[model samples]
Target: MSITVSLLLWVICLSCHAWLQPGRYGLPPPRPGYRPALWGTRLLAPVLALLVTTRHDAIAGILVWCMTASLAGLVVACGLCFGPRIIGTDGRRVARERRP
Candidate 1:
């Protein structure tokens, strides 16, 4: 349960961190009002996850947090890599140009 919570928090953390930098992902920039919220989520999730995991298990909480953080980071990285191809600027599938 704690691991699951940690994984979810890390996912939220990494996704927000990525979303905060829209140009890198080719994502449209979010409204200015959302920047603070995104920053807050990007910063808060990991700390909350740490607290939750530590409450669950003293000896293994750090280990669990590290494992889940790694897994969530990979998931987010793959999303960044493939997401642009899957969904373009106009929210449509990006058509591929063929070459002879």
Candidate 2:
């Protein structure tokens, strides 16, 4: 059971980390400083998983950690993908959108 849980966490962490990369497998010069953030996700997932699972007996603690990880992953992905949309999106459509 612990093995399964650990593998699941690794998969989830890497997958979430992938989302943070801009290009294919983070190739072709990813956005500056993105790699460090990705590494953090990679390291954090398993540590957090272990921390939660070992602190309590049986599968309940693992389940709690799973829930927490899922929620956190959702937040990170959403924030990265839709961050620009949040700027002044008061149901208003502008004639000219700002460009970087």
Candidate 3:
């Protein structure tokens, strides 16, 4: 189950990378550090999910869920906060570079 969750998380990261490529990096070429951080965060999600799902105790599972949810929320908030910085001016620069 943990392996499955890991794979799913990887898939989600890959899809997000593909779909949000331009939006994330503002260029056709991806930045080197971007993928690692994104995938690392994604990889952690399944571990958290597994902790929540397999603890065998209701209270533990609930606590894990809350913690996982908080972590996920933090990840989203970080993305919201930093995503624009990555894609904002750099994206426009990419567009400008493309034009003659």
Which prediction has the highest lDDT against the true structure?
A: 1
The TM-score ranking, best first, is 1, 2, 3
* Alpha-carbon runs more than 4 Å astray in model 3: 1-44, 79-84, 93-100
lDDT of 1 by residue, 1-100 (tens): 9999999999999999878877655566789999999999999999999999999577799999899999999999998776544346556555455559
lDDT of every predicted structure (CA atoms): 0.85, 0.58, 0.51
- What global local distance difference test value does model 2 have? 0.58
> By TM-score, is 1 or 3 better?
1
Whole-model lDDT, model 1: 0.85
Candidate 1: segments with Cα more than 4 A from true spot: 84-100
TM-score per model over all chains: 0.79, 0.45, 0.35
Comparing candidate 1 with candidate 2, which one achieves the higher lDDT? Answer: 1
TM-score, candidate number 2: 0.45
| Clashing residue pairs, backbone N/CA/C < 3 A, model 2 | none
User: What's the true lDDT of residue 35 in model 2?
Assistant: 67
